[model samples]
Target: MIFLAIATCSGSAFAYRPFDGTDAAVAEPGELEVELQPAGVQQEQGTRTLIAPWTVLNFGLSEEWEAVFEGRGETPLVPSGPTELMMGGAFLKHVVVPGSLQGKDGPSVATEFGVLLPDSTGDSGVGASWAGIVSQRWDWGTIHFNAETALTRDHHADVFVGTIIEGPSKWKVRPVAEFFYEKEFGLEETVSGLVGLIWQVSDKLSFDVAFRHALTNRHPVNEVRAGLTFAVPLRFEGAHNR
Candidate 1:
Protein backbone atom coordinates (compact mmCIF):
# COMPACT_ATOMS: atom_id res chain seq x y z
CA MET A 1 0.00 0.00 0.00
CA ILE A 2 1.30 3.43 -0.94
CA PHE A 3 -0.03 6.61 0.63
CA LEU A 4 1.41 9.79 -0.82
CA ALA A 5 0.50 13.18 0.55
CA ILE A 6 1.71 16.66 -0.34
CA ALA A 7 0.41 19.95 1.01
CA THR A 8 -3.27 19.46 0.11
CA CYS A 9 -3.89 22.77 -1.63
CA SER A 10 -0.35 22.77 -2.92
CA GLY A 11 -1.03 19.76 -5.13
CA SER A 12 -4.30 21.32 -6.16
CA ALA A 13 -2.79 24.43 -7.80
CA PHE A 14 -3.55 23.09 -11.31
CA ALA A 15 -1.15 25.25 -13.38
CA TYR A 16 -2.31 23.30 -16.40
CA ARG A 17 -5.36 21.13 -15.99
CA PRO A 18 -5.11 17.48 -14.99
CA PHE A 19 -1.61 17.97 -13.53
CA ASP A 20 -0.65 18.47 -9.89
CA GLY A 21 2.19 21.00 -10.16
CA THR A 22 2.14 24.53 -11.53
CA ASP A 23 3.83 26.50 -14.29
CA ALA A 24 5.64 29.82 -13.79
CA ALA A 25 2.97 31.89 -15.43
CA VAL A 26 0.52 34.47 -14.15
CA ALA A 27 -2.78 35.48 -15.67
CA GLU A 28 -2.83 38.55 -17.86
CA PRO A 29 -3.53 41.70 -15.87
CA GLY A 30 -7.21 42.41 -15.21
CA GLU A 31 -8.12 38.95 -16.43
CA LEU A 32 -9.80 36.18 -14.49
CA GLU A 33 -9.11 32.49 -14.97
CA VAL A 34 -11.35 29.74 -13.67
CA GLU A 35 -10.63 26.03 -13.29
CA LEU A 36 -13.50 23.65 -12.66
CA GLN A 37 -13.63 19.91 -12.08
CA PRO A 38 -17.28 18.97 -12.20
CA ALA A 39 -16.63 15.44 -10.97
CA GLY A 40 -13.69 13.30 -9.90
CA VAL A 41 -13.20 9.98 -8.14
CA GLN A 42 -10.46 8.41 -6.07
CA GLN A 43 -10.20 4.83 -4.81
CA GLU A 44 -7.89 3.66 -2.06
CA GLN A 45 -7.80 0.45 -0.07
CA GLY A 46 -11.39 -0.35 -1.14
CA THR A 47 -12.57 3.05 0.10
CA ARG A 48 -13.72 5.57 -2.45
CA THR A 49 -13.68 9.38 -2.32
CA LEU A 50 -15.77 11.47 -4.60
CA ILE A 51 -15.29 15.13 -5.45
CA ALA A 52 -18.43 16.29 -7.20
CA PRO A 53 -16.65 19.56 -7.93
CA TRP A 54 -13.33 21.26 -7.28
CA THR A 55 -12.70 24.88 -8.15
CA VAL A 56 -9.87 27.37 -8.36
CA LEU A 57 -10.03 31.01 -9.32
CA ASN A 58 -7.08 33.14 -10.39
CA PHE A 59 -7.24 36.86 -10.87
CA GLY A 60 -4.39 38.69 -12.50
CA LEU A 61 -3.38 41.62 -10.35
CA SER A 62 -0.63 42.75 -12.67
CA GLU A 63 1.78 41.50 -15.28
CA GLU A 64 3.91 40.07 -12.52
CA TRP A 65 1.32 38.97 -10.00
CA GLU A 66 -1.88 36.96 -9.58
CA ALA A 67 -4.22 36.05 -6.72
CA VAL A 68 -5.53 32.52 -6.28
CA PHE A 69 -8.44 30.96 -4.39
CA GLU A 70 -9.22 27.23 -4.24
CA GLY A 71 -11.78 25.00 -2.52
CA ARG A 72 -13.50 21.64 -2.94
CA GLY A 73 -16.38 19.47 -1.71
CA GLU A 74 -15.82 15.76 -1.14
CA THR A 75 -17.76 12.66 -0.05
CA PRO A 76 -16.68 9.16 0.78
CA LEU A 77 -18.62 6.71 -1.35
CA VAL A 78 -17.60 3.34 0.03
CA PRO A 79 -17.75 4.40 3.66
CA SER A 80 -20.90 6.41 2.94
CA GLY A 81 -20.14 9.86 4.24
CA PRO A 82 -21.96 13.12 3.76
CA THR A 83 -20.61 15.64 1.27
CA GLU A 84 -18.53 18.28 2.96
CA LEU A 85 -16.44 21.25 1.93
CA MET A 86 -12.74 20.99 2.57
CA MET A 87 -9.26 22.30 1.78
CA GLY A 88 -9.54 25.98 1.11
CA GLY A 89 -6.67 28.38 0.42
CA ALA A 90 -5.85 31.91 -0.68
CA PHE A 91 -2.51 32.69 -2.36
CA LEU A 92 -0.52 35.22 -4.25
CA LYS A 93 1.73 34.17 -7.13
CA HIS A 94 4.53 36.39 -8.33
CA VAL A 95 6.74 36.16 -11.40
CA VAL A 96 10.31 36.73 -10.37
CA VAL A 97 11.78 36.39 -13.84
CA PRO A 98 9.73 36.08 -16.97
CA GLY A 99 10.94 33.73 -19.64
CA SER A 100 9.60 30.93 -21.80
CA LEU A 101 6.36 30.67 -19.91
CA GLN A 102 5.77 34.25 -20.97
CA GLY A 103 7.02 33.71 -24.52
CA LYS A 104 10.47 34.97 -23.67
CA ASP A 105 13.87 33.25 -24.04
CA GLY A 106 14.64 31.41 -20.79
CA PRO A 107 12.98 29.54 -17.99
CA SER A 108 10.46 31.60 -16.06
CA VAL A 109 10.76 31.77 -12.29
CA ALA A 110 7.94 32.42 -9.82
CA THR A 111 6.79 31.95 -6.24
CA GLU A 112 3.47 31.50 -4.49
CA PHE A 113 2.74 32.11 -0.82
CA GLY A 114 -0.49 32.04 1.11
CA VAL A 115 -2.62 31.03 4.03
CA LEU A 116 -4.38 27.68 4.22
CA LEU A 117 -7.77 28.07 5.80
CA PRO A 118 -9.74 25.56 7.82
CA ASP A 119 -12.49 23.53 6.18
CA SER A 120 -16.20 23.83 6.82
CA THR A 121 -15.93 21.29 9.62
CA GLY A 122 -13.61 23.69 11.50
CA ASP A 123 -11.64 20.75 12.80
CA SER A 124 -8.26 22.30 12.02
CA GLY A 125 -6.51 25.59 12.54
CA VAL A 126 -5.10 27.92 9.95
CA GLY A 127 -1.78 27.14 8.26
CA ALA A 128 0.55 28.74 5.74
CA SER A 129 2.75 27.69 2.78
CA TRP A 130 5.18 28.81 0.14
CA ALA A 131 6.09 27.35 -3.25
CA GLY A 132 8.72 28.01 -5.90
CA ILE A 133 8.29 27.34 -9.61
CA VAL A 134 10.40 27.25 -12.73
CA SER A 135 9.17 26.59 -16.26
CA GLN A 136 10.72 26.46 -19.71
CA ARG A 137 9.31 25.94 -23.14
CA TRP A 138 10.66 24.70 -26.46
CA ASP A 139 9.39 24.00 -29.94
CA TRP A 140 9.07 20.35 -28.91
CA GLY A 141 7.35 20.75 -25.57
CA THR A 142 7.26 22.45 -22.16
CA ILE A 143 8.36 21.45 -18.69
CA HIS A 144 7.77 22.79 -15.17
CA PHE A 145 9.36 22.18 -11.79
CA ASN A 146 7.88 22.87 -8.36
CA ALA A 147 9.06 22.78 -4.75
CA GLU A 148 6.85 23.64 -1.81
CA THR A 149 6.78 23.57 1.99
CA ALA A 150 3.87 24.08 4.29
CA LEU A 151 2.92 24.41 7.95
CA THR A 152 0.10 21.89 8.08
CA ARG A 153 -3.15 22.23 9.95
CA ASP A 154 -1.83 19.70 12.44
CA HIS A 155 1.09 22.09 12.99
CA HIS A 156 3.55 19.71 11.32
CA ALA A 157 5.76 20.44 8.35
CA ASP A 158 5.23 19.08 4.83
CA VAL A 159 7.39 19.24 1.74
CA PHE A 160 6.64 18.56 -1.92
CA VAL A 161 8.79 18.36 -5.02
CA GLY A 162 7.39 17.68 -8.47
CA THR A 163 7.84 18.07 -12.19
CA ILE A 164 5.49 18.22 -15.14
CA ILE A 165 6.16 17.39 -18.81
CA GLU A 166 3.88 18.50 -21.58
CA GLY A 167 3.64 17.79 -25.30
CA PRO A 168 4.02 20.42 -27.98
CA SER A 169 1.84 23.50 -27.53
CA LYS A 170 1.17 23.58 -31.24
CA TRP A 171 -1.00 20.51 -30.92
CA LYS A 172 -4.68 21.11 -30.33
CA VAL A 173 -4.54 18.18 -27.95
CA ARG A 174 -1.40 17.80 -25.90
CA PRO A 175 -0.07 14.99 -23.75
CA VAL A 176 0.85 15.76 -20.15
CA ALA A 177 2.53 13.80 -17.38
CA GLU A 178 3.37 14.53 -13.74
CA PHE A 179 5.57 12.85 -11.14
CA PHE A 180 5.86 13.89 -7.52
CA TYR A 181 7.17 12.91 -4.11
CA GLU A 182 6.07 14.36 -0.81
CA LYS A 183 6.54 13.91 2.90
CA GLU A 184 4.72 15.22 5.92
CA PHE A 185 6.98 15.27 8.96
CA GLY A 186 5.92 12.88 11.70
CA LEU A 187 3.32 11.59 9.30
CA GLU A 188 3.83 9.80 5.96
CA GLU A 189 5.64 9.89 2.64
CA THR A 190 4.04 9.52 -0.76
CA VAL A 191 4.93 8.93 -4.44
CA SER A 192 2.57 9.38 -7.33
CA GLY A 193 2.36 9.53 -11.13
CA LEU A 194 -0.26 10.91 -13.50
CA VAL A 195 -0.82 11.01 -17.24
CA GLY A 196 -3.38 13.05 -19.10
CA LEU A 197 -4.28 15.11 -22.13
CA ILE A 198 -5.45 18.69 -22.59
CA TRP A 199 -7.59 19.90 -25.45
CA GLN A 200 -7.13 23.56 -26.32
CA VAL A 201 -10.53 24.64 -27.57
CA SER A 202 -9.30 28.17 -28.12
CA ASP A 203 -6.89 30.71 -26.71
CA LYS A 204 -9.10 31.12 -23.69
CA LEU A 205 -10.52 27.66 -23.08
CA SER A 206 -9.19 24.13 -22.46
CA PHE A 207 -10.46 20.73 -21.34
CA ASP A 208 -8.53 17.86 -19.77
CA VAL A 209 -8.66 14.32 -18.35
CA ALA A 210 -6.14 12.32 -16.33
CA PHE A 211 -5.51 9.15 -14.31
CA ARG A 212 -3.26 8.89 -11.28
CA HIS A 213 -1.76 6.08 -9.21
CA ALA A 214 -0.10 6.51 -5.87
CA LEU A 215 1.50 4.62 -3.02
CA THR A 216 0.77 6.45 0.20
CA ASN A 217 2.49 4.83 3.12
CA ARG A 218 1.83 1.40 1.58
CA HIS A 219 -1.80 2.01 0.67
CA PRO A 220 -2.56 1.88 -3.06
CA VAL A 221 -4.69 4.64 -4.47
CA ASN A 222 -6.10 5.33 -7.90
CA GLU A 223 -7.85 8.41 -9.24
CA VAL A 224 -9.61 9.67 -12.36
CA ARG A 225 -10.13 13.39 -13.03
CA ALA A 226 -11.46 15.66 -15.74
CA GLY A 227 -11.78 19.41 -15.86
CA LEU A 228 -11.92 22.61 -17.87
CA THR A 229 -10.09 25.93 -17.67
CA PHE A 230 -11.19 29.23 -19.11
CA ALA A 231 -10.25 32.88 -18.88
CA VAL A 232 -12.42 35.99 -19.13
CA PRO A 233 -11.31 39.54 -19.44
CA LEU A 234 -12.56 41.99 -16.85
CA ARG A 235 -14.24 44.92 -18.48
CA PHE A 236 -14.39 48.33 -16.93
CA GLU A 237 -15.15 51.81 -18.17
CA GLY A 238 -12.20 52.81 -20.39
CA ALA A 239 -10.54 49.57 -19.36
CA HIS A 240 -9.52 48.82 -22.92
CA ASN A 241 -8.07 52.29 -23.27
CA ARG A 242 -5.53 51.59 -20.60
Candidate 2:
Protein backbone atom coordinates (compact mmCIF):
# COMPACT_ATOMS: atom_id res chain seq x y z
CA MET A 1 0.00 0.00 0.00
CA ILE A 2 1.14 3.57 -0.77
CA PHE A 3 0.24 6.64 1.33
CA LEU A 4 0.66 10.39 0.75
CA ALA A 5 -0.09 13.68 2.51
CA ILE A 6 0.49 17.41 1.97
CA ALA A 7 0.54 20.34 4.42
CA THR A 8 0.66 24.04 3.57
CA CYS A 9 1.40 27.09 5.73
CA SER A 10 2.15 30.82 5.28
CA GLY A 11 5.76 32.07 6.04
CA SER A 12 9.40 32.29 4.60
CA ALA A 13 11.33 29.90 2.30
CA PHE A 14 13.11 27.94 5.05
CA ALA A 15 10.12 27.06 7.28
CA TYR A 16 9.12 23.47 6.44
CA ARG A 17 11.60 20.51 5.54
CA PRO A 18 14.36 18.07 6.63
CA PHE A 19 17.75 19.57 5.71
CA ASP A 20 20.14 17.07 7.27
CA GLY A 21 19.33 13.68 5.72
CA THR A 22 20.84 14.57 2.37
CA ASP A 23 24.43 15.54 2.97
CA ALA A 24 25.04 16.79 -0.57
CA ALA A 25 22.31 19.44 -0.29
CA VAL A 26 23.43 20.99 3.03
CA ALA A 27 24.38 24.65 3.54
CA GLU A 28 27.73 26.11 2.38
CA PRO A 29 30.85 26.69 4.47
CA GLY A 30 30.67 28.68 7.75
CA GLU A 31 27.07 27.54 8.20
CA LEU A 32 25.51 25.09 10.65
CA GLU A 33 22.53 22.76 10.10
CA VAL A 34 20.84 20.36 12.53
CA GLU A 35 17.98 17.84 12.28
CA LEU A 36 15.92 15.64 14.63
CA GLN A 37 13.60 12.90 13.42
CA PRO A 38 11.26 10.62 15.38
CA ALA A 39 9.52 7.85 13.47
CA GLY A 40 7.12 4.99 14.30
CA VAL A 41 6.31 1.78 12.45
CA GLN A 42 5.08 -1.80 12.82
CA GLN A 43 7.29 -4.65 11.62
CA GLU A 44 5.97 -7.46 9.44
CA GLN A 45 6.36 -10.12 12.13
CA GLY A 46 5.96 -8.03 15.24
CA THR A 47 2.45 -7.13 16.38
CA ARG A 48 3.64 -4.13 18.37
CA THR A 49 4.81 -0.89 16.75
CA LEU A 50 8.30 0.51 17.11
CA ILE A 51 9.51 4.07 17.44
CA ALA A 52 12.92 5.41 16.53
CA PRO A 53 14.67 8.75 16.91
CA TRP A 54 17.38 9.98 14.57
CA THR A 55 19.58 13.06 14.68
CA VAL A 56 21.98 14.74 12.26
CA LEU A 57 24.37 17.68 12.49
CA ASN A 58 26.23 19.39 9.66
CA PHE A 59 28.91 22.04 9.87
CA GLY A 60 30.66 24.10 7.23
CA LEU A 61 34.41 24.45 7.80
CA SER A 62 35.29 26.67 4.86
CA GLU A 63 34.01 27.65 1.45
CA GLU A 64 35.07 24.26 0.13
CA TRP A 65 34.93 22.02 3.17
CA GLU A 66 32.18 20.62 5.47
CA ALA A 67 31.59 17.86 8.02
CA VAL A 68 28.56 15.76 9.04
CA PHE A 69 27.70 13.66 12.09
CA GLU A 70 24.64 11.43 12.46
CA GLY A 71 23.27 8.88 14.99
CA ARG A 72 20.14 6.70 15.37
CA GLY A 73 19.02 4.25 18.07
CA GLU A 74 15.61 3.03 19.04
CA THR A 75 14.02 1.18 21.93
CA PRO A 76 11.26 -1.25 21.08
CA LEU A 77 7.94 -0.63 22.81
CA VAL A 78 8.29 -4.08 24.34
CA PRO A 79 11.55 -4.77 26.14
CA SER A 80 13.91 -6.82 24.00
CA GLY A 81 17.25 -8.21 25.15
CA PRO A 82 19.06 -5.04 24.17
CA THR A 83 17.62 -1.99 22.40
CA GLU A 84 18.80 -2.12 18.79
CA LEU A 85 21.18 0.67 17.92
CA MET A 86 21.97 1.81 14.41
CA MET A 87 25.47 3.21 14.28
CA GLY A 88 25.54 6.33 12.16
CA GLY A 89 28.62 7.38 10.18
CA ALA A 90 30.66 10.56 10.23
CA PHE A 91 31.83 12.03 6.93
CA LEU A 92 33.53 15.04 5.39
CA LYS A 93 32.74 16.82 2.14
CA HIS A 94 34.87 19.02 -0.13
CA VAL A 95 33.27 21.29 -2.71
CA VAL A 96 34.80 21.67 -6.17
CA VAL A 97 33.10 24.83 -7.37
CA PRO A 98 34.65 28.28 -7.34
CA GLY A 99 33.41 31.04 -5.04
CA SER A 100 31.85 32.74 -8.07
CA LEU A 101 29.40 29.85 -8.36
CA GLN A 102 27.30 31.32 -5.54
CA GLY A 103 26.68 34.60 -7.35
CA LYS A 104 25.47 33.15 -10.67
CA ASP A 105 22.01 34.05 -11.99
CA GLY A 106 20.96 30.83 -13.67
CA PRO A 107 21.49 27.23 -12.66
CA SER A 108 24.72 27.12 -10.67
CA VAL A 109 26.51 23.76 -10.38
CA ALA A 110 28.81 22.32 -7.71
CA THR A 111 30.54 18.99 -7.11
CA GLU A 112 31.29 17.27 -3.79
CA PHE A 113 33.25 14.23 -2.60
CA GLY A 114 32.73 12.58 0.80
CA VAL A 115 34.14 9.69 2.87
CA LEU A 116 32.10 7.61 5.37
CA LEU A 117 33.88 6.07 8.31
CA PRO A 118 33.00 2.55 9.45
CA ASP A 119 30.43 3.03 12.24
CA SER A 120 27.57 0.59 11.98
CA THR A 121 26.40 -2.21 14.25
CA GLY A 122 25.74 -4.63 11.40
CA ASP A 123 29.10 -3.90 9.79
CA SER A 124 30.95 -2.12 12.55
CA GLY A 125 34.38 -2.82 11.13
CA VAL A 126 33.56 -2.39 7.46
CA GLY A 127 35.88 -0.59 5.10
CA ALA A 128 35.51 3.05 4.16
CA SER A 129 32.64 4.33 1.99
CA TRP A 130 32.88 6.93 -0.74
CA ALA A 131 30.38 9.21 -2.46
CA GLY A 132 30.17 11.84 -5.19
CA ILE A 133 27.58 14.58 -5.61
CA VAL A 134 26.44 17.03 -8.25
CA SER A 135 24.12 19.89 -7.29
CA GLN A 136 22.40 22.57 -9.38
CA ARG A 137 20.45 25.58 -8.12
CA TRP A 138 17.96 27.79 -9.96
CA ASP A 139 15.67 30.63 -8.97
CA TRP A 140 12.70 28.33 -8.58
CA GLY A 141 14.34 25.29 -6.99
CA THR A 142 17.44 23.15 -6.27
CA ILE A 143 18.38 19.65 -7.47
CA HIS A 144 20.90 17.31 -5.90
CA PHE A 145 22.27 14.08 -7.38
CA ASN A 146 24.41 11.70 -5.38
CA ALA A 147 26.15 8.36 -6.00
CA GLU A 148 27.54 6.34 -3.11
CA THR A 149 29.64 3.14 -2.96
CA ALA A 150 30.42 1.11 0.13
CA LEU A 151 33.23 -1.46 0.54
CA THR A 152 32.34 -4.16 3.05
CA ARG A 153 34.65 -6.58 4.86
CA ASP A 154 33.61 -9.42 2.57
CA HIS A 155 34.96 -7.53 -0.43
CA HIS A 156 31.45 -6.80 -1.71
CA ALA A 157 30.81 -3.39 -3.19
CA ASP A 158 27.40 -1.74 -2.92
CA VAL A 159 26.35 1.26 -4.93
CA PHE A 160 23.40 3.66 -4.65
CA VAL A 161 22.11 6.73 -6.48
CA GLY A 162 19.80 9.32 -4.87
CA THR A 163 18.24 12.57 -6.02
CA ILE A 164 16.44 15.29 -4.03
CA ILE A 165 14.40 18.29 -5.24
CA GLU A 166 13.37 21.39 -3.30
CA GLY A 167 10.73 23.63 -4.86
CA PRO A 168 10.68 27.42 -4.44
CA SER A 169 8.11 28.94 -2.13
CA LYS A 170 7.50 31.95 0.06
CA TRP A 171 7.49 31.50 3.91
CA LYS A 172 10.00 28.66 3.75
CA VAL A 173 7.38 26.26 2.42
CA ARG A 174 9.51 24.16 0.04
CA PRO A 175 8.37 20.72 -1.12
CA VAL A 176 10.94 17.90 -1.35
CA ALA A 177 11.17 14.69 -3.41
CA GLU A 178 13.76 11.88 -3.45
CA PHE A 179 14.45 8.57 -5.23
CA PHE A 180 17.12 5.97 -4.50
CA TYR A 181 18.52 2.84 -6.23
CA GLU A 182 21.00 0.36 -4.85
CA LYS A 183 22.79 -2.82 -5.96
CA GLU A 184 25.00 -5.70 -4.65
CA PHE A 185 23.39 -5.97 -1.19
CA GLY A 186 20.64 -8.00 0.46
CA LEU A 187 18.64 -4.80 0.85
CA GLU A 188 19.42 -4.05 -2.78
CA GLU A 189 17.26 -2.27 -5.36
CA THR A 190 14.58 0.02 -3.93
CA VAL A 191 13.08 3.40 -4.89
CA SER A 192 11.53 5.97 -2.54
CA GLY A 193 9.96 9.47 -2.67
CA LEU A 194 9.13 12.12 -0.04
CA VAL A 195 7.33 15.49 0.10
CA GLY A 196 7.91 18.08 2.83
CA LEU A 197 8.37 21.79 3.72
CA ILE A 198 11.00 24.18 5.13
CA TRP A 199 10.64 27.35 7.21
CA GLN A 200 13.37 30.00 7.34
CA VAL A 201 13.00 32.09 10.47
CA SER A 202 16.06 34.34 10.19
CA ASP A 203 19.31 34.54 8.25
CA LYS A 204 20.92 32.26 10.83
CA LEU A 205 18.07 29.98 11.91
CA SER A 206 15.49 27.71 10.20
CA PHE A 207 13.08 24.81 10.81
CA ASP A 208 12.01 21.88 8.64
CA VAL A 209 9.24 19.26 8.56
CA ALA A 210 9.01 16.38 6.08
CA PHE A 211 7.19 13.15 5.30
CA ARG A 212 8.88 10.18 3.62
CA HIS A 213 7.21 7.09 2.19
CA ALA A 214 8.66 4.18 0.27
CA LEU A 215 7.28 3.40 -3.19
CA THR A 216 8.44 -0.22 -3.15
CA ASN A 217 9.35 -2.76 -0.51
CA ARG A 218 12.38 -4.84 -1.49
CA HIS A 219 12.84 -5.97 2.09
CA PRO A 220 10.37 -6.78 4.85
CA VAL A 221 11.16 -3.57 6.70
CA ASN A 222 9.65 -0.81 4.58
CA GLU A 223 8.62 2.37 6.45
CA VAL A 224 7.07 5.86 6.41
CA ARG A 225 8.99 8.72 8.04
CA ALA A 226 7.99 12.10 9.53
CA GLY A 227 10.80 14.33 10.67
CA LEU A 228 11.81 17.79 11.90
CA THR A 229 15.02 19.67 11.18
CA PHE A 230 16.78 22.75 12.58
CA ALA A 231 19.67 24.82 11.20
CA VAL A 232 21.91 27.23 13.14
CA PRO A 233 24.48 29.51 11.54
CA LEU A 234 28.10 29.60 12.74
CA ARG A 235 29.87 32.88 12.02
CA PHE A 236 33.56 33.62 12.32
CA GLU A 237 34.66 37.19 12.88
CA GLY A 238 37.71 39.05 11.52
CA ALA A 239 39.21 36.25 9.46
CA HIS A 240 39.97 38.46 6.43
CA ASN A 241 42.35 40.70 8.40
CA ARG A 242 44.46 37.71 9.49
- lDDT scores for all predictions? 0.82, 0.50
Q: How much does each candidate deviate from the true structure in C-alpha RMSD?
A: 4.8, 8.4
Clash number for each model? 11, 19
Tens-place lDDT digits, model 1, residues 140-201: 99999999898877678989899999999999999999999988889988899999999999
Worst window of 10 by summed lDDT in candidate 2:
1-10
Worst 10 residues of 1 by lDDT: 1-10
Cα deviation in Å at residue 127, candidate 1? 0.7
Model 2: per-residue Cα lDDT over 54-125, one tens digit each: 555568787666676555555465435344544335556665554223554433333433333333245544
Residue 136's lDDT in candidate 2:
64
Give each model a TM-score.
0.92, 0.69
Candidate 1 residues lying further than 4 Å off, grouped into runs, are 1-15, 236-242
